[model samples]
Target: MNIREGKKEYLDMQIPEELHQRMNDVIKLDRKRRNERKVICMIKRTMASAAACLVIFAAGLNTSAAFAETAAGLPVIGGLARVLTVRSYHASEGDINLDMEVPAIENTSGDAAFTEAVNQEIEKIVNDYTAQAEQEFTAYKEAFFATGGTEEEWNGRQMDILVDYEVKYQKDPVLSLELTAAKGWVAASEERHYYNLDVASGRELTLSDVLGDDWKNIANEEIDRQIKERIAADPSASFFGYGDNELTEAKFTSVSEDTEFYLNAEGDVVIVFPKYEIAPGYMGILEFTIQD
Candidate 1:
């Protein structure tokens, strides 16, 4: 895609007055922080690159203005108050590169303490993942050397760890944020983290909020039905529990309150499964819609 053209389209798209004001505020705050510290500027630049990717994708999609704005990583005000990328980090070393986008909230209906607590939680998660990635890279390098692999050969075995976010659904009183972390090397795998927030109360939603007490049985049954149907329609399609010799009934049988999910543009609940969670890595990230 032509990134320049996509950025132009994003800039030309109309934005709500309140949203524009919020963006201005964020920009001003960012500038002030940068002026205060060079390190802060570097952090902001990394975040801008990731946010730019989202804006480019949203522009290419050419969806509604509201959809595009939210998808562009602009802080969504109201309901969940505001959700935006606060920091980003990227590093390349040896045969691996790590990219991460961290999110934060502001002006939440929740008390200041609550907002601070949430921010801390997000920071901790990001830091932990980054440190883990670094350790993994070190281990890989050591193992490669032990195997009599030359530096050139090790460099050729490129690997990557990426973390990014998407705004799946946004409407008054409800906003869904989906964070995905993927690692690519000898094999590919992904893990999804979802946050469904109730804006008015600034509370992160659980499955019970939308699916009620019997949500597990409901979700599992629907997932099982869909898996079977998909496999039937495409013989090559494979799932963890369903194959020529595998246990067919061993498919998804339960869902936790924290199960990854979000609403599609069509307003249907979509359950997300990471790579190899329910199917082969070739499937990448698998999603199944639970129709109302």
Candidate 2:
């Protein structure tokens, strides 16, 4: 099937409950193979001739000389791996960029060069897998169209494909893989309000009141919970201190994987709290320099 770029479509027309489950399953599988050195190399090669240029542009390389050159003797390896993981979220495209070094594979002869070759081959697998995912989704959508459904009928759903991968044979000699999938649906606003209760005990709002105070309060509460969880779990303790300092509220003006927030009591802007890591590494938190 001739696949065209910019053709917005999904894997199915109706988005059945079962299909959502299947889509999520496929997505998990894709993510498992997402950012191996093979995928990184493919992205780097397709975007530019010099790894440095691509690093500066796609990966967001910093002005540091260590980042400006190859890590070890390999192009786009170590530091690149960290950058890819940090910004990509297993996404094929995004605005966030990496500004760091890409470590080289030390030495070129024998096993080392062979290991690099293996890494490049893995990159080919990622590119091919990504292309195949697009093709599969397009083919499925086209087939669905042949059944006489209008494009408008297929408008609400999306096929969100993702991939994740790791190098088992970083020093060479082995190949192993772990893959999973997740298929899901985006809920309609009506469906969302289906079970929601109004704060004042009135009927749930229609389309007009969808973004009213009730929804905002719910959303805000969710955000606060997430931020507090991050601060409590961060290894760096970069944001909230680990002990019994209660956080009645958190004002988050900016949020990402590395989030920034202001706690209720101290009224200070704390930075770079990894939501999941905040609680686990309190000892390490004391070791790092945390700025208020």
Candidate 3:
């Protein structure tokens, strides 16, 4: 599970020592599943990008022989004029449940084919992830009973799966979308995907586009300053290795071209960090808004 912002704060788990130790095994298994999911998503995205290129190229060569028209209409990357919850799943089966809102991009402006490809990929991801989560929950439940967990103790062990999205920015040609997936029972983990669409241009937006060539230095300095300011504002919140905080295996460094980011409504570039990426999991997901 990936932690995210603007979600329910994780509750302090009051698990019994014996049960906690047993659940640790389940948690470890879930970690494995998460890793596998990541690999699958990376491959899916690669395939989607390749497919998009082919689709666009085919359209350009066969449909629009006019180079100027093709270049102007078909974005180099897939984009959307609007986003809507095209599908949803909400059901409960005893202690198991599914709650998701599948988002799809609709580009009436032009290039519906690439947008369709992206939607198909998103749908596949949600379906695959949901199937895996169902299997994991069933296994965990069976194991609990096998390991002598009582009925009363297992009463509230529900697998509430959730998937949702938000539009971070939507101003004419530039649109930013954020998708979040997480398990309600496992608030300690989360996953997020950000999409920045530029209808005016074919290329994806980068930090250099927004912050010029000195993006890394500017971003690093801003993040460091914000981290300190946030910690000062809330004494309980802490980012790993920023000050007197204990060193962790992963620490905040400079932003890269591949770093996760989005454009907010204010047109500010918001840099996003996954939970535990640069801070303790308890802090949830960290975000730094770079303002001029």
- What are the runs in model 1 whose C-alpha is more than 4 Å off? 1-76, 89-98, 156-159, 185-188, 199-202, 240-245, 280-284
Go through the candidates in order and give the clash count of each: 1, 44, 7
TM-score of 1: 0.62
Rank order (by lDDT, best first):
3, 1, 2
Give me the runs in candidate 2 sitting further than 4 Å from their true place: 1-110, 166-292
| True-structure lDDT of candidate 3 | 0.65
lDDT tens per residue, model 2, 127-240: 464455555556666776899867898774454443444322221111122221122222100000011112111222231232233533443455455546656686444333
> Model 2: which ten-residue window has the lowest total lDDT?
188-197
Q: State the lDDT at 145 in candidate 1.
A: 93
On residues 3-82, what C-alpha lDDT tens digit does candidate 3 reach at each position?
66425554554557899778998888765444321111111112344455445555555555464343445333332245
Q: Which structure is stronger by TM-score: 1 or 2?
A: 1
Candidate with the larger lDDT of 1 and 2: 1
Highest-scoring model, TM-score:
3
> Which pairs of residues have clashing backbones in candidate 3?
1-189, 1-190, 2-189, 2-190, 3-189, 3-190, 76-202
Q: What is the C-alpha lDDT of each candidate?
A: 0.59, 0.33, 0.65
Give the TM-score ranking, best first. 3, 1, 2
**RMSD (Å) of each candidate, 1 decimal:** 20.2, 23.4, 12.7
Residue runs of model 3 more than 4 Å from their true location after superposition: 1-80, 186-188, 199-203
